[model samples]
Target chain A: MIRSAAGLPARAVEPVANLWFTWRYVENNLGDITTALSQHVTLTVQAVVLALVVALPLAVLAHRRPRLAGPVLGASGVLYTVPALALFAMIYPLLWDPRTTVLIGLVMYALLVLVRNVLVGLQGVDRGVVDAARGTGIGPTRLLLTVELPLAIPSIFAGLRLATVSTVALVTIGIIVGYGGLGQLLYRGFNSQYRAEIATATVLTLLVALVADLLLMALGRALTPWARGGR
Target chain B: MRDDDVLGAAIRWLNDPLVWQGPGGVLARTVEHLGMAGAAVLLAAAVALPLGVWLGHQGRGGAWLIPLTNTSLALPTLALLMIFASSGLGFGNRPTIIALAVFAAPPILANAWTAVREVDRSVREAARGMGMSSARSLARVELPLALPLVAAGLRTAAVQVVASVSLAAFVGGGGLGRFLVDGFGTRRYGQVLAAAVLIALLCVLVEAVLALGQRLLTPVPLRTGRGAVARS
Candidate 1:
């Protein structure tokens, strides 16, 4: 009676079967999974690097001319308000390319933080220090490079770290438009109701994000030794 | 369809009286979207604000935890939604709320922590000198000063949540997302365009209201004279 009330046998339990099945899937499709993982990472890197290239100069300009700061930050803040999927829909028709849509969306999403941080970093330099540098005959360019930029490294890196991790997360939504990455794995897994597949893909995607974040943190530490123990 | 055709259709959809009523109507969808997003933000604030303030007041635990919270943004909402969906938790509201609430927590938590932590030491000392207890000092002095940032944090979280509720459509949920998801599914470009416009407008409205709140919360001194220029 108790056995009957328990219903299905232990072998029929969902979780164990799902685990075993996932193990088999991983064993059989290791190469494809790796490719997906790499694709996701590549997409994240491309977007973040592109955003940095554009945002850094813009940030410096804003920092130099305080009048521009409000407008620049406002524009990026407006861009940030647009939802990822909505942006994907708007861009897909115009660009007609999944990768381009995803890349552009990621870059736009990244701008607010990257620009804000760079500006903040630059402005954070002491006015006294700037005056001192001027007093010592440092040129405008030299002063920026020697004092301001170095001091800004930690904040700039903080922004980079944020942009990278968020880009990793947002890349998943691009699966709808055929920018296959670990997100594709997730989509397929959910569609097939394969517990193993869904679990593995989610974990793998999160791991990729975690690894990327840790790497950036380490890179920041290595680059900004002066900012180290001060924190 | 051409751009003009899409715009025309969307305008028609917007004007249609039929679209304004019923369970699947625009009004219903907006309410639903607000319900889910509002609940998520409220829940997140409930947990994040008090804890963040406490830690900020104590000046402990936040050094590491805040950064960790920030990193939680890396966790995909869709992945979280799916995991919860598959756990027999059913689809739509619950999973979406859970995912959004998690996404919403970080900004509020981080900002609140910063606001509380940065409250002037002299202010706290003054409160103590007035014979206030630690809790009293924190409640009266630290928290009031932290209000502007805390409000700003709430604004950020609310806007993000509003935008993200559209993801609920992906998992058989209700919201303005239905227009996007259902339209895309049916190749109804007009609906998709219309939905996207509505979401953007909604974000703008939320931001404007909250910006006013933040401005009002700013201390009187910070709004005028030298303090204003310093902040700017």
Candidate 2:
């Protein structure tokens, strides 16, 4: 009976056979998957790094000028609250170029967390520490680098962690515009009705997030040994 | 018939009923969206809070839960919605609830867990030394102290759920997301902007309510610059 089932006409078996075939195809295309993942990582990292570069200064500027913090942070929060897909859609026209969309979207999302964290981290620096730094004759540049940065590490790390997680997750939205990422796999899996592909991509994305979280936690621990020492 | 014509056409498109109808339709949709989000939050709290408290009080192997929650928090809500929709599950409210529930769970779980764990150790010790039963001490002491943090988590989850439930409209689930999705398909910029603006307003409103609730529930002493502090 089993043999006869396998021996049945090709059309009779194509659905079940194709399912396995698609699974194998995905397995064999591991290189494509890796490339997709690398693209995702690059997009998330570059966007986050650029956002930090921009946000850190803006945060400092706002800190120095308290009135600006409200508008700057509020605007970034509004941008952050825009749904990932909607944000991508809204920006698509101005760009009119697919290649730039991923960068644009990622950077926008990064600004949401990076800007908030920069402000929070900066503000969180103990007031006494800033006064002490000033009393020590440190200039603004040296003060930010030496005292503010170190003291703000905990909040900064928290923001980076939140930003990293958000970036990794939302980079999948890039697939909507033909940008490569794990989201592409997820989209394709759904569009093609391939359950195995969907499960595999979902699981793999979760693993990537887990790994990233662990790595960040480790970095946080290393940077703030006091936190780990239960102080 | 150059730039002004284009601009006029755009403004006219924005005024069209198809573009502007959802907000007027919001009263009906907001009920559905709120119902879904509210139920998910309630469900998540019921399950996650107790487990978090137990794990925290046990003080053994609780570290594992935090990472697990953090990892789960990273799951992309939209992708999950798409994947679930394609499984022939019949796209609509049910799938939206499940996705939003899953999205909201991690924050609730992590916050509850952290809040319980962070309760002043001296307080716990004093309770225990006074011959209080484990369950009693947890109910009377740890839970009260943890309420503010847990509330903070709920607030985060609420904001996330509100934003995420909008994605349900993408798959024909019919909420505020419907307006945004329709706006996208038709390129009605005003409708899209209006939908987005409304969603943001909804988020802020919900956040404000939750903040107020948090303030009310917290004891006055804890409410003052201490309890409900934003998590680092």
Candidate 3:
């Protein structure tokens, strides 16, 4: 449309304008593309990190106090039931900041996924291992530090991977607020009926999610060198 | 400090009769939302169910389920909706439903596959011992045993679909999300909040109903076995 407005296409306008995948669009909008991508990555990472921060202590508490697990998870479940779009809109009244609204919503949404997984990971450490550690004159803190935390790393990584990817997808809803990252570009494409922009942004979002998940999996392996190919 | 806080104003907006009775009333918008979500889930079920059931029966597709789920979870529904709308499918209900269906498929497929597979192996052998055909055993025994989990999957899909149907409004398709988009555009945050509350309640209602359905779908004997220890 900008090119058409620039009189770049006069005769073959329809074909050129309607093309869904052109290198020209990518080249012309490289800055915008990179900004959206970086913003998307930033929002996703921030949300997951915040969620992990909140989830870890709660998950530990829940793991330690079994009774708390039900309530913690139940609360997160209720929060999760609130849809992403609605959550963003709901947060706007109080915060009045678009990025914060998206951030808060992403954190709230990822909380359940992270908390549940982390709790499972911590609880999943074999009781025999803990008992054995205790029997070998290891202190409570030592048992947890040496055995439980290491064992739980895989599940925590799984949670982190899921939260990051889902948060990446949810960050697009930030478009409603004014900071939806690549979501903004996708929305712009939708509004202007620009297939190239839509397809490009969509593929980029998926790629980002894919890369994040893969990196987490690799990190999980690096951390848990003891875990070869099982679980 | 004031009755004009978001919650108070949202309540006031919800109390307005005008918001409840028009061509664009809450009732109509809600029905439209359900219609779109229902269609998407059903469409997804149609495709995913049989494939999951077959895969589970054969017990070979477990390798791909996690990857499939991770990929599906990463697919942005809004992007998919936009792509479908822009790629000659045009905007509105068709594109929205198709896009939402893409979101609904993974949970249903994973659940269906796991549900059927989780049926006890010895139970299957007993069915075969009774001379029941493979198909007959699956239909009568395995499927019934799997009903609870299958329904759980449907419940997840239903809630997800209903929650996401609000995206329809972004594409000019009619749904409760219209209120959110319009309200946001007009800076009517109260109405937006009210509509969101309504949608969240709808999700909870759907979840509860399907949860009940799952329990009902479970065979009476199996339900008893799992929980009610009748060991006298």
- Please list the C-alpha lDDT of all candidates, in the order they appear: 0.82, 0.74, 0.85
DockQ scores of the candidates: 0.54, 0.36, 0.72
Q: Model 1, residue B182: what's the lDDT?
A: 85
Task: Give per-residue CA lDDT, model 1, range B1-232, as digits (tens).
Answer: 4454777777887888998799999899999999999999999999999988988998887887666676678788888877777777888888899889988888888888888998898988999999999999988888988887787788888988998898888778898888887887776777777778887788778777867777777887656431121111
Best by TM-score: 3
Instruction: Name the weakest run of 10 consecutive residues (lDDT summed) in model 1 chain A.
Output: A12-21
In angstroms, how far off is A144's CA in candidate 1?
Answer: 4.9
TM-score of 1: 0.86
TM-score of each: 0.86, 0.78, 0.92
Q: Which digits, one per residue and each the tens of the lDDT, describe model 1 over residues A1-231?
A: 234456854454454454514478898779979988888989999989999999888988998889999888777777788888888877765666788888888888887779988898899888998899899998989988888888888889889988888888899888757685888877777777777777888888888888888898898889888766864
Report the C-alpha lDDT of model 3 over A1-231, residue by residue, as the tens digit.
Answer: 345666685554354567778898999999999999999999899899899999888888888899988778767776777789988888887888898999999998888888988888998999998888888998867777788889999888988888888999999988877789999999999898888999899999999998998898888899998888875
- The model with the greatest DockQ is 3
Clashing pairs in 2: none
Q: In candidate 1, which residue ranges exceed 4 Å CA deviation? A: A1-16, A19-21, A126-151, A222-231, B1-5, B217-232
Which number leads on lDDT?
3
**Alpha carbon deviation, residue B154, candidate 1 (Å):** 2.0
Off-target runs (Cα >4 Å) in candidate 2 are A1-23, A27-39, A63-80, A93-102, A119-138, A145-158, A175-180, A203-231, B1-24, B87-89, B125-132, B225-228
